[model samples]
Target chain A: MQKRYCAIWFRYLLTDWLAIRKPELKDVPFVLAASEKNRIIIKAANQLAEKQGIIPGSTAADAKAVIPDLKVFDFIPGKAEKLLAAIGEWCIRYTPLIAVDAPDGLLLDISGCTHLWGGEKGYLQEILKRLKGKGYYVRGAIADTIGAAWAIARFGKEKAIIEPGGQTEALLKLPPAALRLDTAAVDRLHKLGFYTVQQFIGIKRSALRRRFGEQLLLRIDEALGTAAEHLQWIHPLHPYQERLPCLEPIQTATGIEIAIRNLLETLCNRLKSEGKGLRVAILRCYRVDGKLVGADIATGRPSCSVDHLFKLFALKIASIEPALGIELFTLEAPKVEDLMIDQEILWTPEGCGLESPQLAELLDKLANKIGAKNIQRYLPVESYWPERAYKPSLSLSETTTGKWRAGRPRPSLLLKKPERIEVTSLLPDNPPMLFIYKGEKHIIRKAEDAERIEPEWWLTQSPHRDYYLVEDEQGRRYWVFRSGHYDDADSQWYIHGFFA
Target chain B: MQASKASIIQQLQQKILSWQGFASPAAAETKRMGLGPLEDAFPNGVFPTGAIHEMLCPTREQGAATAGLLSGIVTALMKNGGVCLWISADRRLYPPALLSFNILPEQVIFIDVAREKDVLWAMEEALKCEGLAAVVAEVREVSFAQSRRLQLAVEDSKVTGFLLRTDLKKLTTTTCVARWQITHLPGALPDGLPGVGFPRWQVELLRVRNGNPGSWIFEWNNKGFVPVEEPLAETEQHLTRQVG
Candidate 1:
């Protein structure tokens, strides 16, 4: 058996081909003209205009002579890049090792995988046929070497691969530009009566190297598979992604649950084999009705057990409605970490029952039922004032322990807003003697002074307050305060906060 | 062995007093009854857990601070990883300000909503959550019909819920375990500093399930609240009354 190497080159049209084709300009002459106003250049040209001798890099006015009434559109670089990315993503169906040749092409390494489609020719036909059915015009070529395949895809008469050790004969009729040389080098070769790659091949190797430099000779060598060309494939940072395509659509909850269970089993097995566990899993069900329903669950720690994952999914299954039946199910573990594999000491005998994980799972279920934001965890804020010492968070995921402040005794219940009261007492150094609050008056009976908590000057510029607990003639107690510190001219007593 | 009738009656009274003060070993098994006193009552007793209680405030301003105090009581009870969910349609709770009462922000979850219906829905959901220690829902207007629904929901979940109504007059036909109206009270001043005294509020326990509804004046303290037992002492009675 002969060894075979295959390279699948994919191209993305950066232009809005659909918008251009909608005006019946698909078969009409059109040139994507670039402007010098901001140093932009024409990026692509339609086939009709290319046939009319109006090529890319030609000035807009010059192209107008070849084909008048040429429609012009403003060039948007960002949109073009996004469209290219979408195309690159779509090309993932062909090969996993897809490299973005940016702004317009993809390089795929489909070496051992081509046999799945009965060889490269059949695979190329299937891909082109599907893309054309989706209203796309594509040209593809495959070869033993990436350089030869790339050259043949762009300029060869037929979009077919050049067999192993046959690059010289296969590329003979092609122009020198097919060698993937720079524009200047190709023009230089053309000037030297070397229009065809065959002419270049006929020249003496040493003379070609001495006159045209080693770069040109190296291109020839690379095209003929004599030199090695390495390509880097883009790899996702996190990888436990599995996708299942069902031949029969599943709409019932039971059917979806079964499919989910199968996927979870496969995913957990993969995690165990890798000595890793997932912290977060996202299940995306692509419905045939064109709606995407996604359910995501996060665990406190990395876990690979099917039961654990199923419990989390159970909390969120009600949220996912499999409308119009789901045709594809994809489960991705975007976050994963190494599992803790240490054994507990026999002497200590760690509690092996369901404890923390069970509690966390219960909370997750409640959160899913009553919206995530409704379930909150409180984190203590480091503040001297009673009401300023804590904040509410969505979950216990945020561990901020060092922020807790000790020593001061805070009230169990603090009023949301302090109400103003009429107090009859001297200022600067005294607690209230008699105060009327909420339209009632009571004589002071007994009282105790709590320490004054001054606001942190660095954090906030709030005034100092003297907090005190007092009793009334009616034997009722209240938490009240006098705002401002001594000696400040602007210091005035304002009811700051109340304690329950 | 013959004795006078009066002397025999006196001996019988002494025996009854001893029996009432100290329970016999056999009587101890029969649990003392007669409905324990109110938890806040000085001589009454402490409030029992797993029981429903209520407090009502007549005015908005008076009720606001009292509500905070009630939250403090809830927080103190929730020492064992307990949580309180505050479902409200009217009041806007600022988390930082509530921390002074020693209520951990994590322990109290405030749900601020716009519609009255949503407030009831949130209250029902909070009550259903088993981990929560208690739920306080503030509805501007809760009808008797809606209150029945809430009562049933809370009963089913077996969680304590505090329903604070800004419009006290609107609570016409709902059956609550207790009702209270907190009113502002005059506070005593410290000796010789010449400034306004600390604020005070009178909590009126207007209704109770099996106890007497009476008002108690409590002085809010930094450490905790203390009931004003001697509001009318002889030494400063005239002076305090004049100030009031």
Candidate 2:
């Protein structure tokens, strides 16, 4: 099989995207500018701006003087690459192997895929027509090699498609810049009066490597099919996926449910047989209008239960909108894990602790309803500070490495942040006599001695806290602390928690 | 004639209790649940395990007090190395504090959801899991229908449920087996010591199905609940005066 590659280039990638978003800028001359070395330089310009002698790389001020009504917008960095990648993903409908050519293009390995659209000419036409319909000005070319396809897409003048074995002939007339050479190499070639690639096509490899560097020779060999070009091909889809093509588009929630149930039954059955379970599952619905809507569900632990997984998807089915009906449904489990077989409980009346199937299923339902992050299990950390005493565990089966600190009367309800309270103590070091919190006065009848605790030296630099357990007349206990030493003039008292 | 009439009334009461799904337990099977005389208030003189118990905590202080009392009960329920679920919109029950009531913090799972509806739903789902020893939910409000739903879930699974009602704006009737109110009581050290004493709360049974309602003072001594027989001199006088 002859490996044919296609490259599609966006002439004004950034400006075209901007015009599409704000259609009012369709006819206006505009340039996207960015501050380079503290000077605003145009990064991309529309065709109208280019026709009016305002080009990219010129200062914004200079471009403005040339056309006073020119619209200058801030150029967002990395916007072009993001647009190209998204376009490449959309192109997956045509071919499976797509690589993002950063800055302005995409490369598709359409080796065996072109026959699906009849032939190479039809494939190239279909892509260009669809992309142009989406408000993008695109030019595409097909060739035997990626290098040739890329060069012809951007710089070829005579023809867009190079014949299968005529890459050398195609490269004979194009400029040296068409070979994707750096500016210095191209400038050297132009200084030597070698205006076209045909002038240097017969040069010896060793001589070209010494003068123009290895990149020039390598590009030539890659273009003429003497060297293999490896591309970072994007993985098309997850390995564990099932697709359902609907005879009639699904318009109701019940129809969607049936589709999901059918998909899960197949997927879960395969997973169970493989002794594996899914941790995350996504259901993507392709509508008749070429738009896609998706719903995703995640479990706390690996799950292969069809009923349990269906219940999770059922919660999110209401959020999916099947406008004009869904033509296809695809279920993919991107994350999976080895599942332990069910442990039969023969005699033990009390079930397993956290690893029990029932507990995990219950948590999965809760997590799917709320979110997985909201469901938490905490383990004790060895710390004196109440706020730094515990951390969330990773999973249900995790155990604490350290013992929980006891012998200290910790508050049951600790406030998220300490609240300031107005206090009056009889002496500099004695506990407060009374405190007013939230505009309400409470007389302190009993107070405990202050327990001074210093902040962790490595974590923070702050004042030590002198905590006092004080009881009000109504028998309510509050955990209050003074910010600094009692003698410090700026010391403040804050109520930290409520003790039962 | 009086003896015969009293016996007839006792037999009729037993029949009514049986109708409401409260069967009298065998004498040997009724083990003391460490709640002391508080357990006697129940119909069969046993702390109901397979029922929903609703506790009202109107203020933060009361909420903390209820947390203490609930942890104490949970410790007894989870003595056989079972896990418990704690679901709330925003939980403030410090994990370390559970240590004081003889519970390993790791044995309890906390689910902090944003909406009360999710909290109730999670609570009901957790209650349906027989593997969990108990399920505690801190919800702002639960209607009669919602509470009844939770009660029905526990009826089949036989899992204990504790509904901590933080907001009492609409305290409608529900199918919960009991309603409780726990408030902080002043800590007292023996011989007038200077430090804070063990936790003490005035546990009150505001409502109970086919059971007597009463208030008692109990203290947690790091082992189990110890009912404080006598109140302090001043507060006792104050309480008597208010009652009179």
Candidate 3:
């Protein structure tokens, strides 16, 4: 296959990323700024900020002077590189061979992959349209070589592609800067009256190398397919695993516990050395009686703690019968990620909750003993929609997405589905004085004011719920709500949750 | 020769008393398990912590009463913020409701196993965890020998085990510290006013290997359980009908 290359340039990557998370900042003038020793310098500006004469490489003061009400944000370090690497990963959907072109670009080898998308033109259009829909300003070009594709994408004035073997002719029309030569060298050539690649094409290679260093000739060679360029493909993380063979076929529960502990130690050591942690593992015991037993352990956070892992495994050791005897044990970490630093111990041991690690160990034990789906921890999502107000997090160490906007108190236990109950109320909007739930009648001894939770008008068509915190005669607090208005005598009232 | 024989006899008697847990170590380790007046029947005014106790509820309707009684026991045992595990084939425990007894939801872990085999396997394993305050297991039937296995595990770990026998008909016999039955009773409204009242339970001690057995009426209000002098005497059918 030919080494066909495609380069994508994200011109306003930082600005676009900011706007994607915050849609209200689309037309507003904002700049992503980086502080260097107390000096705030603008790195990238949104489309509107650019139109207002704010550009990169200017100080925040200069940008604000241009537009007084400009909003500036602290640029997140390594965010651009991470985004480019992520795009390099996503580009695997286009072609298997791809690499990061750095700062704000991705390179993909699309030789045999173009036909799958109906030729290079449709492919380029599709890629551009998809990225544009994601709020990114992009320019893409495909050529026979990566150097040629990169030069043409950023500097070429013609079509996005050069005809086969016609790159040299196309290269002649573009300026010397298109070859990726240093800025100093390009300016020197401009002063020497050699402004375009066509002027240098007539000179001998040796003469050009002696007059202006070898870098100039190498750049030109690389751009015209005379020199080779390397591309690095993104690879996924491999699963971590370990296996152990027992010399003796043991049948006791104690023997199985020892085998599981040994397997955990070997697997966890490997994970720890790589600065990684495991979230899920499979421990399999093969009995000599021709039967196999396996137990799956999942942790609340990415952890490689051998002791904690061993305890979770010990809970299931009783299930392995070892009918005749067991001979082999294998442990594989199927889910792993970079280790995260949970908060340090700040509170007393007998505090409201356990320390993060202690809590993680406890959750892992519970999840292993019980079913995984029965446990959940929710973090607030940045939304006003009721259903989207919070999202179940995968790990306990995940940083909060946004501040949990406080309103009225929420119940600790919410029913899977709200159950409709029969309520007796004195006034139209008053709290229910008596209600029957699950066939038991509850009389409200005390009630708080009705807390109205209106639906997000732009997102849904559901009726508003007016919730009340009512204490039953047994002194158990319940969260009950009346759906919609009370003009009808039989309006639906539901028991939503129980307050601890 | 008579003095030598008498000394050997005294040594054997002391060893037997220690084995029967009538000596110093046993007396020091036994704790008052918050069984109100029931503690007076034991050798010391305490309930044994390193022993196995059984609570049998005959039908599904009585499961809630047993759970409520167990929640109070767990709260008392886990005074130092220790954890408790509940293992069963079908989990119907509403954990948030236990908060009424000052037992936080996070302090308890619930395990539901589909196989009867795994239920005992997990319970036996949990009983061996000295870190835990107590282990409550719900199984239909546990033979006397199986109870002995659970009892042996607790003896080493000093973890209290509650074997809640959901199927009460198989009351063959087991070597347990005591056996209890919790039945839901009609809660009396103060002055006969028409509203729901506190949780009232009729607790019966069916058998005790080494202590006296009797029955008591307990009223669980917000301030915890309080013994009532007179038991509520309504027919059982009337109470089941309200819940059904």
Candidate 4:
């Protein structure tokens, strides 16, 4: 029940990494070195290089002098840190609570996870076996405290899982460097003839603080579990998501639907109690073969009604392929909004169909079956240009404050972009007599007055447009615009839209 | 009880055809949506509400005319202030133009789905909702089975559905109240005025269940459609084929 931690010390991490890349180099004496102002310093050494008295942080020249045949490698920046973090992520299989100790080590909180793998012995064995099998030289130790585990892993003679309340005894034989003190303090301790932790274990706290500063006492107290130091474990992220792990993998549509309904019930209940509603819900099904298929739906208004949400999701339920079988399903409401309840009306306000909640749900279902962008309602804006005259509104209840653009006839459908048309006008300024669009010639049977729409000079340098409603021989009406003044050489004609 | 089994089936089918939608009417009488002389074209002198109608157009020009005609119809259906849902693979109906047809830009909801399957599915969903006045769908193809499904959905909720068939004319077997082909027609000049005429549509009734098929000229003046007297150049019995 006590908190337990595991420390994985990656000795000779850089050389081990190079050896993993090149198996032939493992038996050779090699050192990873960094260049500083034309001086090469050893950062890490392989086991063979370490035997020749080559010390890391020492000059590469001294390492080569100790062993002339020592292989040298450029120290890659952040490579060791990245490798340690990757190994820590892999350790999620062992314990979800794990953190990168940076550079060359990982710390794992194996308190509750150890029993899942049949106790600490089996858990430690599995971790060591897998990491070592990956071509890395690793030393691992477990203790009640992270500091104690870290010290025992890097400095202890035996790689043992120290029982709870045994951290002090376990750290006694280790060197003072195991306290993770600064180099200056370690040398000062050595000058004081306190090489082993056993020599400082019985020292007075105030006296130790006076001689070696408070850091030493803090380190010793942390290892002994008298002063707690929190390990920055990998914090797991759980959004407004509900996960359902099935007892047996479900392959049938009915089974999947049932699972989805169950998950939705719990999720919707949570949102409702929180006075919030989901604008979008994504249902992800994890297949037995490690594949994922999902279906998502969006609501115009925030909604928590189970039946309505179910119907919206039901529209696309057929699209989700169950595949071989689905083992887990996660329903997540990634976009949510506050559900502010509207004041109940004593009398129905004309029942314009927009105010009814049922209508909102119906529109949601329709949008899902089609798409969100496809369902649009517009409101008048205070602009003269056709594109700026109105704006697409998400909610039908949005009131229009601007005056509706005059009673002039606008095309039933507006083209996404105006298309160029070849035209011949009666005069230089008159409406076109004949026009060519899409290779089809349209003879204008009738023409209306040109409504001059001036461009916003502040917006662009384009000229004003003279828009005319013309009826072709086919009886189809079109809105055409001529850009720029008649005197301008670059004046162009375009068919903007159709009149229904 | 007095009718024979086969006769009963025939009568029941006739009743179903009279109803035209997915479900029977909540009210006893079938809704008559006919304006002017067009009422004579439908069964019981009424434009069938809560039913599915086909508006077929062969060309892109005619398709726009058909959209105009349907917008008028939808606006009429929602005169009591309701929403109209329009679903299409590529939506060409400009929201601003619906304003000229007396339908507010906000009253009409447009859904542009890239897939025909989703368009039909959305139509069915809209047709099942009791709040909507009508649903208009522009699609490339609608198999008899798909139309039947749409018909069934509209039947129960009594929501009207306008199947605006554009680009193709492949209506063989479908259970719609009426099949129509609308063409762009020259609007009549009011008292010989030199200006654009009111929006006119030459509507050809290809087939009508429990009613006689006929062709007529109509002019929409925003308020509603008014039957305009044609030149009377064609014979009454002569069947007119729909032009692309």
Candidate 5:
């Protein structure tokens, strides 16, 4: 069997960004116009404007004359590029092998992936249905070559053509502009009575090459798939997935737990079969009543054990509301790696290592049961102030130990915020003599001055602090401090943190 | 050899006697005994696993500190790899106190839902989740039908469930193995201590599966709740001093 290639073109309007910003003008006759010097440049004309006889590059004045009710808007280049990138990201769900065919299109290499959505026709139907649901008018095409697909999507008989092993025949019906040639070459071809690609192809190749140079032949060869063309396909960073389609919609917690276990079993089996372990897996539940609920868990290390994975899920299953009913369950291993499986040696002493996956599972369960933001790993910030020394991380995957800065002695528990204290002591540059905190006055029987640390002047406007380890009259010790230098105004007293 | 054998038998006998009062490491680690002997008489010698322990208190207007006492006990238990699932029906749980109690915000999962019906449903789901150490569910009133469902779910999962009943008037006839009425004790003044005064609670164990119901006063200490034993003896001394 001869090998054949197919290119899928995803065409989007260049001016869809503007349409999104002004949704009211979506179906209206609108033209994107730019002004250069004193002349108006028409960048793009929407389908509604095209039906009103306004074409791209027509002057703003000409478009108004052509259609008296035409809506003209200024063109924004950078904004449109950002919007296209966002659309490109959403398109990644269909195929990981996606490349931005700049300005207005996305090229997806759906060769082996089309089967995932049932086939080429089904895939196209799904894409069209989703885009239309989001209020977009799009055109798609699939052919044996990128050039042929591009031409078909732009100027084919019905705006979408599926040509299999007929790139030459497909291009013959398209206009010279469909070859993606410059405007001058298209006009030159038009003047030479070669209006259609078929006319150009019928002429002698050597004569055409001699007359129009080798560029024309290159374009023709590219459209015909005789020349080499390269497209960069994006590889997703992580790619392990398992999907479960429930015959009966699951509404109860028991039902969801069963589905979770089934999905985890399949996912772990796949991970083990591949000799790989998953580090992160996301469980997405599509509720039948239209709500979407997702639970994510990250292992400290790569793991493929079904029992361990289900334990992590057990901690999080309570947070997932089965809502009306869950119709589908999907588990995706977005992160994976080859794990080192160690064999136990008899009579050999094994060193204890932290079970990272267990810790990560614990954290994941807590985050799910409580809330994602509520459970965070504290990373030490490079600051001397106790309150500013630690920062919370959203995921436990971030290493919590090495990130801390050395040099400062940190308390195990730091107060969320500093408490103010009433201090009356005669100390110009030393520790306080008396202080009252939590409505109890404590006389300092003995005190030792530790260190006076100043804030980072370049980053913050906070004042310097003089810290003290003071023993109260009752024998209990406290860590207190006075804010700001004595020379600076508003040198007040505050109890910043506690050590227990 | 004969003397050694005799000593070994004596040690075995001692070990067997101690085993009668032996507590699981999980129980010891969670500070279960610190909450006083009244709770220790029940099954498991503490809050029985695989059963629903209900805490009833009047409305917030009536100064119910049920959540505070429950939080303290739950926080102590959380140290032993046990998670606390807090299910709230109407009121929002304060986050600051939950953090201070050493219950990592992530450890206390709060389900802020509407309607008592949904709260009961969520509670049943939480109780059935294995590996969870305990579940604290707050509801206005748990109907007899709902309580039966919860009892079955707890028994199946073998996880402890605390049903915090805010409505003290509408008591369900369905037995929940054990029920406690929690009331706030009067705050104490600082007694020459630099730190804040200790918290207190007056607890009345109204029901037990196979034990007698009684009331007790507990002082919240650094470790956990300590029983105020010999309350009459201490009160008599005060009365004599007042008469003198």
Candidate 6:
């Protein structure tokens, strides 16, 4: 079958929206104006204002003269594009592919989709009637090419639907301006007495290029179906999405679970065959009450196992509320990675370390139950600060070249931050003889020599810390640090960590 | 005739222990964790793998001591290149300190869950994984039922589990193979030195199923656990109380 395109034009896109919002603005002769170059120029004129010779692009002062009762409203930037995008999304129900034509039109690829609405004529009528009922004036035209459909939608006076393979004849009667050219090019064509496309349809290729430049020839070829035109859809097609449209609304958890199982089975089959695994998956339920509820699950590693993926999603099944029953269920894997075929070994050998598939699956379950950030793996780094000595590894397979510093006696449990302690020392720089922590006094029986650790100069200018391993009389060991030099009068003491 | 009768009685006792889930040393991986005489307090004269051991830590100091001691044992279990999972709520176990115990810090995965309930959940899940060497979880409390569930998971996977119970207020009986409490002891330097010596702890086996309960002083040097004789002359007699 031949490819066909349909273009829908909204003549008064913004004004129609304003009239629908404020019904009083329906019959008023209004024009939307915007300030440009210190002058308020009219950007769009309603039908009533248009009939009164208040054309757009004229100064607001001149438009006021044409109609003394004319109401001028500010032209909001990007309002037309927003309106077109909303309408295009709604048009997805008609055709799966819809692209915004910008300013005032939409292009839909209606090749295989027209048969769903009985034909191109019925399809065009259904869209135009629905949009018109929403208080907007819309015209739609269908042809073999996007350029031809676009031109006919905005300029064709007699027909709205051009027959298939008739774009050439349909484009012949339209004026040169309908080819969507720059204003300068249109003016040049008008000045050359080429009022309609038929006037230059038989021109020599080299002569046309030299006369009107390359754009005119390109536009003509696109209009006549000799060249292909590509369009960017509003919603990019999801390649890993599976949809289940239920004949009856699903109200029970069992039904929803069945839907999810079916979707995952199909999705996992595809992933396994393609040697790819899903890293993130989302399940969206479209309820009958016009509300969408979604649940998403992510994996620590790329996985395609049906049972494992199902378990992760099962933990999140309670969060999805199927209020009034769900009519549609869509499962989409938005992020995926290539899965090595050899990683699918069913029986993992003993002591596989981090490379074990069972370990990754266990972590994925825990992450989904709580969160991903709560689970972490650390690798040693060459730093003196206790906190900076290790960095969290992003993946299980990540390795580090730096070895952990084992020369010094680091505490088994390091506090998140050091706690202030009241101390009484015999001398200024000597270790505290007795310390009061949390209202309990501990007399120090033995104290190690102070190991002064200087702050990394490049990172911060904090004072050096003199750390001492002090064991209380009760045999509880604590790591305490004295800030700054003893001469700094403001030097304080704090308990930093615990030793086993 | 008397020797034959004694051998039959010993064989019957071994069968009864095996029926109670205490496998013979040859039947399971009999890798010594270098705990010296401490292993004698467990059934069959071996440290129980595929079983849960609960450690009571009433204070932060005890928690640190427990972590240090567990890391020493974990190093032996991970000799086959297996990884270990350390699940806790608000974990403060510094990874760099594990290096002193001869443990590759990267080989131990740390999970910091905000909820105490999830810590147990993660531990049970980690215990079920056969590839892991062991799972060490720190929770404020664990109900007997929760500990039983974790014990069941480890039994099938043959993975060791250590439960560091920080809050012993609700301490109750559980299905753990043994319960331990390790408290910090004042380090003793050689020849009256003026610095902190190697990590020394008074390891007490508070409860052990089907075995004797005892306490001893153990010190972690550069290599492994070494049983230390208490320096007090009067308590030196109790140092030999552990049965082999």
Model 4: number of clashes? 13
Q: Which portion of correct inter-chain contacts appears in model 3?
A: 0.01
lDDT by residue for model 6 (A261-362), tens? 999999999999898999999999999999999899999888999999998888888889988999999999999999956556686556757877888898
Task: Give the per-residue lDDT of model 2 (tens digit) for B98-186.
Answer: 88888888889999988878888888888888868889999888899999999899988888899999889999999898999998777
Q: Count the backbone clashes (under 3 Å) in each candidate.
A: 41, 0, 0, 13, 0, 0
DockQ (Cα-based) for each candidate? 0.12, 0.52, 0.12, 0.36, 0.03, 0.60
Worst lDDT run of 10 residues, candidate 1 chain A, spans A348-357
How well does candidate 6 score on lDDT at residue A459? 94
Query: Mind giving the per-residue lDDT tens digits that candidate 3 earns over A53-147?
Result: 88888899998888999999989989998898877776778888878877888888898888898999989999999999999999999888887
- Top candidate (DockQ): 6
lDDT-best of 3 and 6: 6
Q: Ten-residue segment with the worst summed lDDT in candidate 6 chain A?
A: A340-349
lDDT, residue A40, candidate 1? 41
Q: Compared with the true structure, what per-residue lDDT tens digits does model 1 show for residues A380-421?
A: 777776666666676554657645565543332345666677
Candidate 3 chain A minimal-lDDT segment of 10 residues: A347-356
Worst 10 residues of 5 chain A by lDDT: A348-357
CAPRI classification of candidate 3: incorrect
For candidate 4, give fnat to 2 decimals.
0.62
Alpha-carbon TM-score of each model against the true structure:
0.53, 0.68, 0.54, 0.62, 0.46, 0.72
Model 4 ranges with Cα > 4 A deviation: A1-243, A270-275, A282-297, A315-352, A366-370, A436-441, A472-474, B1-34, B190-192, B231-244
Candidate 5, residues B1-244, lDDT tens digits: the string is: 9999999986775476457543333643333535667766564455565678888866441122565566666766566555566666454344333443455544444555556676776677767665566777777788788889998897666677888787767886765878887654433345554422344455678888655587676665545666766468745653474488
- Per-residue alpha-carbon lDDT of model 6 for B1-244, expressed as tens digits? 9999999987887889888867676755677889878898877678888889999998999999998899999899888889999998888898888888888888988888888888988898888888788899988888889989998898788989999887877888998989999877777787778877888888899999988899888899979999986668625533443221
Q: What clash pairs does model 2 have?
A: none
Query: Per-residue CA lDDT of candidate 5, range A1-500, in tens?
Result: 22223333333365555676688977788888889778897888887788777787779999898888888888776655566567667888887767666666667666677778887788878887887677666667777777887778678886354546777877887899998888888888899888789887988999988878788888888778888777776554445788899999988888888998998888788888888888788999999888899888876567888887887787778889887789999999888989757566575322111222433444444444445564334455566665565565565335544334443222222344567899877858667789988888878765555568888888788877887756554334456777877666787787754322
Which of the numbered candidates is closest to the native, going by highest TM-score?
A: 6
B-chain TM-scores per prediction: 0.71, 0.91, 0.83, 0.82, 0.75, 0.90
- DockQ of candidate 2 is 0.52
